[model samples]
Structures are given as C-alpha cells and as structure tokens.
Target: MRDEALPTVTAICRALIEQIDSGLLPAAGKLPAERRLSELFDTTRITLREALTQLEAQGLIYREERRGWFVSPPRLLYNPLVRSHFHEMVAGQNRVPATEVISARQVPASPAICAHLELPALSSVYQIRRARRVDGRLVLYVEHYLNPAYFPGILDCDLRQSLTDLYASRYDIRYGRVRFDMVPTALHGEAAAALRVAEGSPALRITRINRDQHGRIIDCDLEFWRHDAIHVSVEVPD
Candidate 1:
C-alpha cells in the first residue's frame, strides 16, 4: 500500500539503491554527474541532490568536494582501547593501509596544544600533518604534535612510517598510558581539503594524548575520520 508520486525523491532513492544492489553502480564507483543523474531521473537537480544526500547519510553513497558522488566502501572497525596504530589496525583487518605526511615543521604551540602537551606558552613542538588511507580511500587526516625536547632531530626522520615504530626504534620510548577523547565534528579547512570532502561534512574528531613510560606527556594526536567510514567497537576486560 506504499506508493510515492511519480519522480518522487523516495522513488529516486529506491531506484539508485536498486542500481547499486544490481551492480550497476559498483562499490567505490563514481556515480554519474548530478546533471546527468537529474536528467535520467526526470527530476530537478535539487530533488536529485536531496535523494543523493539521503543515500549518503544512510552510508550508501558519499561525495567528495570537487570529486562528485561515489559508492561507499565497507566500513572499518575501530576500537579506541586498542594500542595499535592506524597502519597496524587497518592491515590487521585485511585492508591496505597508507599514510602520507602532508606537512611537518617545528612550530609554536598554541594555547590548546600547549595545554594538551603541558608545555609553556609558545614552546616549540614538532607539528606533523598527515593523511591516511584505507583500501586507497582517504579516510583520515591527523595532526601530531610532539614535544621537541623529547624528540630531537625528529623532523629529519621518515615520517610516512608509523610513529609507533619510530618512537620505539629511534628513541627507545614506548607509549605508556594514553587518554582518548572523541566528539562528533564537521570537517573544515585543511582537514576537509586533505580528505577532499566538502566543508562541514559529518566527521569524527578523536584526540589522543600519549604518555611515555616515565609518565610524561610525549605527544598528542588529532584525528579526523569520516563518520560513515568506521564502526567503533571496544572490548572491556573484567
């Protein structure tokens, strides 16, 4: 008994889903441009876009700024309690993982970063910006601020590799106790640009404050992840 008007948004959504389910719009495949899709659906661009957005919110599709819409890939599982880094965890899940250092430099710590690292005003820190990919899909952009005092000459190290390994091998330091904070956020500025997503796209911001074996704050990480790209699960031991 459920029916919609001809060329309705719901009908458009259903048609798109059927196409996806039938392999017409394959996973990770870019959809037709909005103009083409709108013409095919015999609907206004606004209506077609609304349907597209609805599907995006359902995790059926996604759009990258200047890149257009695409079928979403399988979501990855993320556990905050795990000590594994992005590369390890992603590979463990049988997916390819990649990280590229976008920018790295010694900079004065802002008040927020200073508080996170317990540093004095304008203290110098190693600011490393990075973008990480899973299965060749850009999913996360992170900023790592390290206390330069603990890591002399770190700017010269190969930063594309995992910092977890770098710290252990080079500095003989290990991550001891760590604190995590997460909040729903919108992508903006460099983060959005790095991920190639529209500004204000739904995202998750995860802040990690890491401590060394001596219980000194070693560094902090700001991770911006696509909301639909991860399913966060945690296991608690009794």
Candidate 2:
C-alpha cells in the first residue's frame, strides 16, 4: 500500500459512512462497483478492498459469494434464560436503563396480531411504546402488545420496572418459555426518532413472543437497538 494512498481508503470509508448517515446510501442498497469506488476515491483496488473488509467485519457490509458487497442489515438475539427486565439487563451490566413511553392505547387486533395471540379478530389489544436507554446512551425502541383481557389495568402498572415480574407477582402468570426471532430491518422514521438515531441506521430488530407453561402466548414484543450495542453468544451442547 502506498503510504500516501493508505489514508485514502480510511477517508473514503468515512465518507461512505457519512453518506449512510445522511441517508444517501439507503438501506439494502448495493454500493457502487469496486472499480468505480476506487476511481472515485482516487485509490488502488487493494486499498479499497481493505476498507471494505474492515467495514464488513464491523457489520456494516455483506460480501455475497461471487457477488459484490452491499450494506448489511441489523440482527438481534434474545436469551430465554436471561429472564431480566430491560432495565435490569442494563443495570446488571453496570449500565443504566431509561424509558420514554412513546404511546399507550387499546385497539382492535389486526389479523397478524390475532394469529400470534390466538385471539379473535376483533379482540382488543394494548400497545405500549417506550424508548430504552442504558448508561444514558439510547439503545432500543420497544413496542409491546398485550391481550387487553389479560391485563385489564396494564397502564396502571409500574412501567418503569420489569413487566414480566409484575405480571408474575400481580397476576400469577409466569412465562415458562420465550421464543424470539431476529430479522433485518431499516429504521423507519418514527422508530429512528424514538431511538435518537438517524433513519436507516443499522439497528438490531428483535421479536419476542412469550408463552406460559400451558403454551399459551402471553405477549408479543418488538425491540429495535443500535447494532453496535449488543453482542450475541451462542453455545452448542456437547
């Protein structure tokens, strides 16, 4: 690598990230060709590849086999045994947890919501939105859906605390199992605003479906966090 051109790769990477921040490089959009990028940055292919590799490792880009690299989407993982509240999770890690309730209301269940909760189509559902924070750093935007019949006075509960614990103690309901799925998503305008991050910024998308010992679904939650704030570890049994 030429000493003078070495800095160019870093500079170009920074510029590309800036474009992403500015919404110029939209999510799921393929980046310009490597040759084109090199030409634009006035650098060699080697330097460009180095920069792309670094970004790829940072979870910013994905290199398809035989295909070119494109901006990578976000991913989040939830642990069933980590039965702590959002606040508790952060606190245990020596961080802080803050919540800003975005909205709370009751509405008719949609088809998707009805199927998930095994409820009637017109069943009422309570939706709560809260922006989550840790150590004063914004982390995620959470949306929770509960069967209104199950939590008649949910809004009156101490929302700043662990909702699961509250349900277990107050309603005698316990979640014996939790199923979650991770998916790639772009930051919608409203979610981005709540998270205090730019729209389309890399974010981890998590859907948590909770169930009791009887295998009845309790609640469905959607969480969006900054991609960099979380690390997921998986262990395979011997």
Candidate 3:
C-alpha cells in the first residue's frame, strides 16, 4: 500500500513544482488553502501536507503563524565589507526595501554594552530598535546601542532613515573600522515575536561594533536574521 502511494505523492509534488517554476505561483505568493490544494491535487490532506512539508524543507516555501504557506523569496546577498546601506544594497538587487523604527530612547547601558562601547558602567546609551524588510518580507530585527557622549540629541533625528547617512550629515562621523561576529542560533523573546517567526527558530545573530577615525567606539549593533532569508558572502584578500 505504501509503495503504491509513493507514486501518487511524487506526482502531486511534481505538479506543484511545475506550477511554481512556471510562475503561476510566484515568489512570496501564498499557496492555496490546504483543503483546496488537497482537492486540486486529488490527494488526501495528509499526503498533500506531506508534500508541502517537503517543499518547505527544500527552501521553496515558508509558513507563518496563522498564515498559510508562501513561496519563498530569493535570498538576499549580503557583503559585510561593502559599507553600503541596507536600502542601497537591496535596491541594487532590484528589490524594494523598507525599515521600521520600533522605538528609540536613552537608556542606561548594561555591563556587556558598556564593555563593547568602552564606556563607564551604567553610562547612558541611546537604544534604537528597528525592523527591516525586503520586498515586503520582514528579514531582520536589529538593536542599536549608541554612545551618548558622541551623539548628543541623536534621538531627535528620524530613526527610520539610514544611520550611516545620519552619522555623516549630523555629526561628521563615518564608520572607520567595523568588527563583526556572527553565530547560528535560535531567536527568542522580542526579536522572534517581531519577525513573526516562532520562538526558537533557527537564525543568525550578528554583533557589530563600529569605531570612529580616532578609534573611539561609536555604536554597537545586534542583528537577528532569519536563516533562510540571507546569504552572507565576503571576499578575503590574501
């Protein structure tokens, strides 16, 4: 019985793949409801769902909480060394990019944040949280800690704009040297909820520290990205 069912499953999978490839189901397009898809595929719901799961594992589809599956978008290429803003890089790839400022406020730095910024314990730092989207898909959530001494009244500026541009125009500050450390980890807490992904989902956590030309630390950033939404590439010179 199982052997006979294998061919049916394979057929259903192939038909769906063909639809996706033919652009009938475009990237970011939502798949039909499971019941409708089951009927269309002329297969049992269990069998149809199994096929969908396989497609998801293959990086062709993704599921959202309380939302049906959608065709996965092409992964964004990220080059850390480029020094380009997020919007510019996404635009270079012909994709629309957007950023949302969740919140910005002055806060006392924690021990870890202080250490990263080389500030005294409990020093004031401006904390900014942002969510970035590509082609209408939320892909990254970031928390920025700025050394308040270097950026007085920085919170008054528009937080939705690119920080790189703001730093140059307002404070004559440009990034000098950046240190990046990335790790594969599970996202949790506010970051997970903001990205609309399940807690403990696989993600990449990247920490970046930026310094000024005088070697003064300007800010530290923590970014959480969905594992499937980005590809990191860097050219190393020997």
Candidate 4:
C-alpha cells in the first residue's frame, strides 16, 4: 500500500507542470508547503524538492526563500528604445507598478561609480537604493547614483516617483543619450535580500549610463531583475 503511492521525480515534475499550464496554479500563486506537496505528489520530500528546483530553473516557478514557491508570472516585455520610465512602462503593459525607496543619501563615489559617471574618485553623489514591484511581487532592485551638480536638492523630493519625470520637471533635465549593458548573472548580497531570494539565484543585471538633454552625464543605474520577471523586447526601426 505504501509503495503504491510513490511516483518518480520526473512524474512529479510533469504533474506540477501540467497543473501550472492548465491554470490550476495561477500565476504568482504560492504552491503548497513541502509536506503538503510531498503528499500530493506521493513522493519523498527530497524528490519533490528536486522537481520544484527544476521548475524554478526553467522559469516556470520562483521561490521567495522562506515564503515558498510561486507560479512565475508572465515576463515583462522591456524595450530599451522606448523612453518610458518604470511606472509608465509597466502601466502601458497593463501591470501594476510600485516603488519603495530603501535608502537615499549623499555618498562619496567609489572608483567604479566615479568611472561610470566620469566623476573624480571620492566625489559626492546621491545614491538612491530602491526595491520595485510589479503585480505586488518584488521583481527589481535598483541603485541610482546621480551627479549632484546636475540636480541640487533632489534627495528632498519623492524618490519613489520616476526619476526621469522628476529630472525633467524639477531640473529641466531629460535623457539625451543612453548606454545599456546587460548580462545574465547570479544574485548576491543586497539584490538577493531585496528580492527575498537566496544568494546565487539566477538574475538579470542591467547597467545604464544616462546623459541629460544637454549631453552631460547625469547618472548611472545598476538594475537587478528577477530572471523570470522580465524579458527584453527590442524594436528597431525599418
């Protein structure tokens, strides 16, 4: 009787994927706890975990560490050529967007930071750290290092709002030329903690260097996106 209930690891993964594809497990919906899942799949907890881990690697599911696994949502389509900011872009795609300012202050730029904005080492810059959400799930963690010379007293404004919009309205600054660098990498330290995932989790890192309307370098951004949460969609002119 006991042996009859057990299923192979592949069988368990197949069962879960079938459920997910059939919409039985809705996107962003948390899967049952390990014990419950083991029973549901009629497999050992270890076997069940292996199946779940495979699903995670496939981007079919995501685990928020202690929060358990959730069905992965549709990836956010991102087009670098578009000028829309985070809030605007998410809204345009019919997804709810939110930003939380984690920390904001003037800090001495490190060598790497200085190099990105072409500033001297130890130059004072505004470092703004933020955790952003889509559909109520934390998906992006970004740090914005802004040259204070361009926008004075910017830290006093609402950091949760789109910096692009803020720059234009307050300092008459707008994007002129932008540079983008991206790579698939592993999450660590602050980025992993911000997204509630384990260190070494798969991630997408995007680095952007922004020059303002006057062609002056104004800021540099480091963005870490959950691997399953976004996909690039570039639109080139004919």
TM for every model, in the order presented, reads 0.94, 0.68, 0.86, 0.95
Return the TM-score for candidate 2, rounded to 2 decimals: 0.68
Regions more than 4 Å wrong, model 4: 1-7
lDDT of 1 at 107: 88
State the weakest 10-residue window (summed lDDT) of model 4. Answer: 1-10
Q: Residue 160 of model 1: what lDDT?
A: 97
Q: For candidate 4, write residues 57-167 as lDDT tens digits.
A: 999999997889899999999999999899999999999999999999999999999999999766989999999999999999999999999889999999999999999
Cα RMSD, model 2: 9.7
Model 2 C-alpha lDDT per residue in residues 36-91, reported as the tens digit of each score: 99899887898998888778658776554345666644333434457677767666
Clashing pairs in model 4, backbone N/Cα/C closer than 3 A: none
Q: Model 1: what TM-score?
A: 0.94
Candidate number with the higher TM-score (1 or 2)? 1
Tens digits of lDDT, candidate 1, 112-136? 9999999988698999999999999
- Please give the RMSD to the true structure for each candidate, in Å: 2.8, 9.7, 2.9, 3.0
Please list the residue runs of candidate 2 whose C-alpha ends up more than 4 Å from where it truly belongs after superposition. 1-80, 236-238
lDDT values, one for every candidate: 0.92, 0.75, 0.89, 0.92
Clashing pairs in 2: 96-135
